[model samples]
Target chain A: MTDEGPLTPRVTGTVRIVGAGLLGASVGHALRARGADVVLEDASPSQLRLAIDYGAGRAATADDAPTLIVVAVPPDVVADVVERELRAFPDAVVTDVASVKLEPLRELVERGVNLTHYIGSHPLAGRERGGAISARADLFIGRPWVVCRDGKTPASDLALVEALALDLGATPIEMTPEDHDRSVALVSHVPQLVASLLAGQFADAPDGSLRLAGQGVRDTTRIAASAPELWVQILAANAAPVVDILDALSQDLAAVADALRAPEAVGARREVADTIRRGNEGVERLPGKHGQNRRFASLVVMVDDTAGQLGRLFGDLGALAVNVEDFRLEHSPGAPFGLAEIAVAPAVLRDAITGLEERGWKIASTTND
Target chain B: MTDEGPLTPRVTGTVRIVGAGLLGASVGHALRARGADVVLEDASPSQLRLAIDYGAGRAATADDAPTLIVVAVPPDVVADVVERELRAFPDAVVTDVASVKLEPLRELVERGVNLTHYIGSHPLAGRERGGAISARADLFIGRPWVVCRDGKTPASDLALVEALALDLGATPIEMTPEDHDRSVALVSHVPQLVASLLAGQFADAPDGSLRLAGQGVRDTTRIAASAPELWVQILAANAAPVVDILDALSQDLAAVADALRAPEAVGARREVADTIRRGNEGVERLPGKHGQNRRFASLVVMVDDTAGQLGRLFGDLGALAVNVEDFRLEHSPGAPFGLAEIAVAPAVLRDAITGLEERGWKIASTTND
Candidate 1:
């Protein structure tokens, strides 16, 4: 089925979602929104009922044969579910949305499952909470959805999975299961561990120290609030790769500690400075908005904490026809004012500033300075 | 001198700023905006002239004997400047805005310089760049301006420093030099090191791994982009406390690495889960906006990439009379749409959602589900 809209991707055939958790329910929602027929299944009857009630999809029946089967279960049971779905739906191309790919693929391979029709995919989008109630139709929109396929997999099967990702407004990236696991370990898993451990240090902090916490600490430790139970499964499933990255990070942390301890020694300060400088280079390597390498110039505009101040600023920008590439609002603790940092294209920076100034909004700094 | 405005703090004497860098220039601008007679001084002639041209203050003269002196110089030279200022203007209540407090106090004590008129303050406000050109008059507004006092400091001197902070629209927080140093070490200094080291890991990551980097990694390493040269000085001056925190962090990292390496071992998974769980509790201890433990409910509103979409949303919010306590905009890597997470008082969440939905905006999820 295809929906008639520029925003909707043309996806055909019936899609079966075999879990009613966050990822599965979200996939079903997105697909159903685009007029694709979706079938929902879950081991828990309540979850299945909730997904259906939430309009993700209708209950699946034995007579229904789907064109594609998406297995969205936990990592520990991904292999088992994928195997069962493949055996049950021999005519359907099967895919699983498990965070870690290599282990499950290995397990399926060891179990002698025919994997020609199976592909492993991971949509790198999630919220803090799970379950069907929290699922949204746009959960995967604009996110990176990794599709893992071996050389033996048929092109038609790969195309079907890619179409699904595209229809859901995600970018489909092709990678081997091994590469996918390693990439996530470096980018996601290791960072989560670092944030958690860093935040863990706060437990022993002196009484008043936390009261002094600022945006720096808040941002650094934000992900530490993630569910421990979910992370345990993710970390354990991708233990080998995650552990390797953690080992490297530990060595670096040790070096930083040594350097800080004896900063007066020759070369110690340089070592500390070098690590921080390398970090600068590393962060710059990450792509900017819209997955592009282009950078935008930022200007800070001052606003009062009063309700309509931000609205007025944005309205002024709209009148000036300045497109804000990005925006961040910074409010100091106990302060009744805020600074809105607006990111705009370099070409429009001067015009945007002059326009805002003409509108009586104070420009703090055209450059971070 | 007093400005005829309710927002202006009542101060009736001349204020002199010694350094024409970001902090120094900002102080001059704020005091001048409040109609205080201000004199600016700087080692760099260009910076001083820039501050003067920016309407921060006039150039300092030998005849200018200000009642209050703010020494806003680099950490390495803060003590020297503070001592010189006290000697130059014996009657002036002297204060220095340096990140580290204990070192400067110690240096003055060792030199036998009486600090009866001197108070150390550090405004917990800064941007990535530093210069007179980047200064903002309202930089310290609503931020914590920590005033470090000792027994020898007279009540009048303490009151003068606090008055300066208040006049500049900052909240004055009093703490002993030792306590202030320790508090900042826990909240700011150590988080900086952790972020830098964590970002350092990305330097050698396999190509394309960073393309998968999400907000979690971005925030965890955001502070790593700060100037290494500046951090080197801050970290060095506060070496002892920062090193202590780093040592503890190192031990934790080692334990996490060990746990991840053998996740299937007895209690290994539990250990991992425990560390992350502790992180949750630690982050929970941090006060939210307004420096209160109260939590705000968040709802995500979807907006298209078209110009004026955000403006329309904000305008709608204003029309509905909803007070947004905090806001965060999340855009996908390659998506043309963005999610605006608006934090509102819990009492108004239902009304806000209903109002926005009535206005035709798509509600992604109310609870980050």
Candidate 2:
């Protein structure tokens, strides 16, 4: 089981994945694809056998000792299964892929298990779907694989977890368990609740009101389709941070509500405007293309319905040695008029705008608004 | 004079759209597409010529009289423009396509303009781009066109406006000007603020934080890239209602936040859970598939790496006469598993689930989640 220079790396010892569910099977598929020996374990023999039959892993007997153990199960059962697996494999580096990190990390430590080999990890990739048979080798590719490195995590444990993440074609992001939970609470948990609440409005609306819904309502409530049980666990675990953000949001909403009741109050309108303005400020701070947190350049062009006019406009921009980031088109009926909005980098904004204007294009100016 | 048959209606003159901007052009386009005679007027000769050239209308001369006049201009200028257009065309039934209604309506009435020929309408449709060239005839199709029929609006004026909306292929939604503003504040204005605030957080995020973003961040902040000035005007105009919604949200957020800061505090966690649970309840209320407020049935099936297993599974379901509304696949790492989430009509859920399980497929229980 060895290799030298110019030879392929020897197949590593099997990495045992308990549960053989979505996360567990994904790990096996990824590891197996990378020439690592993978072993799958599941209480459901049918599920386990399917994983083996699919070449996700070799069938693991009770006596098999693997190099690593990845615990992938429901959040409530993660602690119990992780502890059992740790006991089953005293030497392997054990990690659990759970959404909430700190609670599980603390629970394992409190249980007085061997902490040196345990590393907490969460790969932030998921779909509305669930379970082992859904596992894909490339599922984690290009996604962030968060590795929680704490005092209890040994150097070998960190290295092995990092290696595992790398092997699965994931980017290893080092974060504290607490930080991970807080970040996710703000970005994921709170948003999900917001989306759900917004969508829920339709449930109580009269039939007539529901029929009036357009694309805006649809887009705002898209994430409401998430699994309720899974989301409940996520929200519960990240309760504190999510509540903090919501509180701030609540204060903003309260101010807005007051303004609506009596708009003539001088400062009332400003107060409401301020909250919306703050929202505006907050939204602009989000990252853009390929993770660049830069302002988008908007180009407004007026066109007609000559077939291929849009394609020609886009083609012309491409020929001008300018990169078109993103564009949206607006057409007015009977007017045979079209407005095309194009997003570009900030550095190129002025040049692109001026260039388009020079080409006989009518660019909408924000200053005029 | 126009000829008319028993089946063919009497001659109706053009619906004159003033300003020939994005909104006006869109109105023109929609009307023209629906076989309505349209003519547009703009103070700027270049814009007026452009509107005519773009086929928004056959050139509208100052001497021309129309059956309807649509005033489409900026919010601040709406009242003055509507008044001027009313004075200009005494015989035409008039409507101003403005976002904020009460202010403009009050301003026009106070000026002692002829009230019998005028109504206020707002078609809720737009794109990021603007101006006459951006107009598309189909812009208002299937969208809610609110007719603000106040006590002063003549019955004839209201009827003509509703007829115009029908010709433009828009769903006529009747509401008072005040109610329209308030409703929009909750649905449209406040959401813009929320999206903006979320995006603003990334405005100064550290490089590392920026790199860690995923699809969630992208989606939540998509609307943040809107026109700043246009939003400013909208917020300023409807500050009262937006403030009201924001204030209400703030109160809820504060209660949740207090719960988070003291997780061990007895009722704190419960309150947070309750709020989240309410959010869950709310999200489910949203209309699903073709305007029905029914929960779609979901079946989660475990899958493996067998070639064409998914294709065959879908085929098998099809063969079983199951109509799958929607489906998504997610792979679980380490588990060598894949989970497929399939949506169907509620009545078909149990049957589909049983069929899949009977075929040796391990389907997770829906109730468990």
Candidate 3:
């Protein structure tokens, strides 16, 4: 929810977005699609024309007094761009969308820049690629738009930022700069670093080691494809928080390794179990959809290799109106046999189990009692 | 390759598969697909008919003189069935496809029987559902079929087993039972545990935190949907190896945790970086086919929120006659702008990057160097 009280009028004006890159152009395009006037500016004349030609905005010069100015530039240059815009148009309420918050906020404060109207925001949506030509009006839809509002953020300016997020079809989340940085460090930064480190191991693999690699390792490290330079900057900025999470993960990994080397030691085995158990406990703490905890139920069915059998089973479930949450099969060795584990609602387990057994299906389970 | 000599005359005959469940029926189905004489035997008359109706196999009674007997049964009773088959059809070659070979193999050896004609095999393949009704002939295709051949496996028996893999269109990989268990522990078993641990974290999350999960967490923990009992048995049988890998992971995690708790220490940060970096290195070693590890050379272009820009970009690339491997977009704030990363082959990267830039597009990087 926006910080402003209810019944406050949202400012409706020609929202002008400078830079016309991915975020800039996407904002203009979304605003325009929603029947709002959008004007765009960029230092590159080619980018300016492309934004206009692409229908991202109506072409506008720097002289226009836009009520709101969005500075979408590179991380290294965001502070400079924001300062320049302030000098260029002092009347506008300015904001910047840089990934790291503390650095830019520090830069503005250190320079003694007037801060009453500036807010720091980051829309947590991205892809592996970048640029203005890649911008889409629907890009931010359903994503979190984090507004790092400080004490200096005026009531009017905060509402304008929130309105911009809502206009772009994003969920606006208000967070302190430190909280935002720490959370992202734990979630985004750490994952990237982990992937990069995993990928880096392959740089010195033997001839066939890589070719023989499989899906497990691939899934675990797919995020390694991120840009090196951008990550370097992000990691450098959020180093403190990210390092903390990494330390936790590393300690856990070391203990696991030591336990494997000495399985006979009961102490080590218990530690192994404890770590696994802790991971279990931690995973359970994660939120569910719309912010709720989801309960996952499971069922195991014995199956054979034959046609129409699966169809019949699913058809039977459909007949009984038992909704399967999910299902998995593990093929047993020695002959044509396997086990199928089906997940369903806890409320329906008894009926579903009985329904299958009554139909002559061998449901393999230890009695509940 | 089969164990038989380069030009040994191929011997093919009727093979009877008992049980007709996922594994049993898949054996029959795969053999049948390769034009083998597949005869199926099952206690479940309905399942027998289902297998026949699905064209998995021709029906066979208890008295057939089968060239091979494939006992696809549960681990708990693998010995009983293997011994029963041996007493019934002493001359026929016998094999069991149990996940764990040592226990079943030991059971057979303990029966004081001449096991010269018997071999053990395990094919790693499956889905999240089961039964003869769920069987597919192509289920084992392209999957690793480990043939456990050792001191007890007769030369003739090895040839027969290798021929079986060929008939089923499976890639036969020969490894000592111990090595096979270790490799799977590193690749499959440990991965399952990790995924489950990750998934379990979501069980207790507040509604808000759960809603924040994206595709990253989904893909990373997808294997969590596996059968619990089957995994229990798998991990139990390969406990030593899995424990070894987990121990390694735990050690790394612990070190990381320590670093997180004490970020002010230089050694802590460096150690954390190393662990994260190691994960990145390991990630690159993974193979990519369906989520494989193949690298795509990319061209990043800056674009705006304009109608038809994406279409034109794609059209221009198509016109360049270079295959675009993949594409992603990063939208920025302030302006509706973004950077588009387009993946192509290294061979095509130069042409594509130059071609786009020549057309007056803002490219992120034009050269790899």
- Using Cα atoms, each model's DockQ against the true complex is 0.60, 0.15, 0.13
Using DockQ, give the best candidate's number: 1
Write the residue-wise lDDT of candidate 3 on B1-369 in tens digits. Answer: 112224321337778787787889988877776667888878789988998898889899655788888988766667788888877888888887877677677778888977777777887665455668777765665566888887867788788888887666566777767666666665666766665554544454344444345445544655555555455545555667777666655555555555555555677656655655565556655654332445767776766544345445655676677654444443332334445666666887888878877877766443241
Alpha-carbon lDDT of model 2? 0.67
| Candidate 3, A217-311: lDDT as tens digits | 55656676565656655666666777666665555555555655665566755655555555555554544332334564656666554433444
Tens-digit lDDT track of model 1 for B201-297: 8887777777888878888888988899888888889989888888888888788778888888998999889989988887887766777767888
In candidate 2 chain B, where is summed lDDT lowest over 10 consecutive residues? B1-10
Question: Considering every candidate listed, which one attains the maximal TM-score?
Answer: 1
Off by over 4 Å in 1: A1-12, B1-9
A-chain TM-score of every model: 0.96, 0.79, 0.76
lDDT of each: 0.86, 0.67, 0.66
Model 2: how many Å of interface RMSD?
Answer: 10.4
Q: Write the per-residue lDDT of candidate 1 for residues A155-202, one digit (tens) a residue.
A: 999999999998888899998888899999988998898888888888
- Backbone clash numbers for all candidates listed: 3, 93, 137
lDDT at A62, model 3: 50
Model 2's chain B yields a TM-score of 0.78
Question: Which of 2 and 3 is the better model by DockQ?
Answer: 2
Sorted on lDDT, best first, the list reads 1, 2, 3
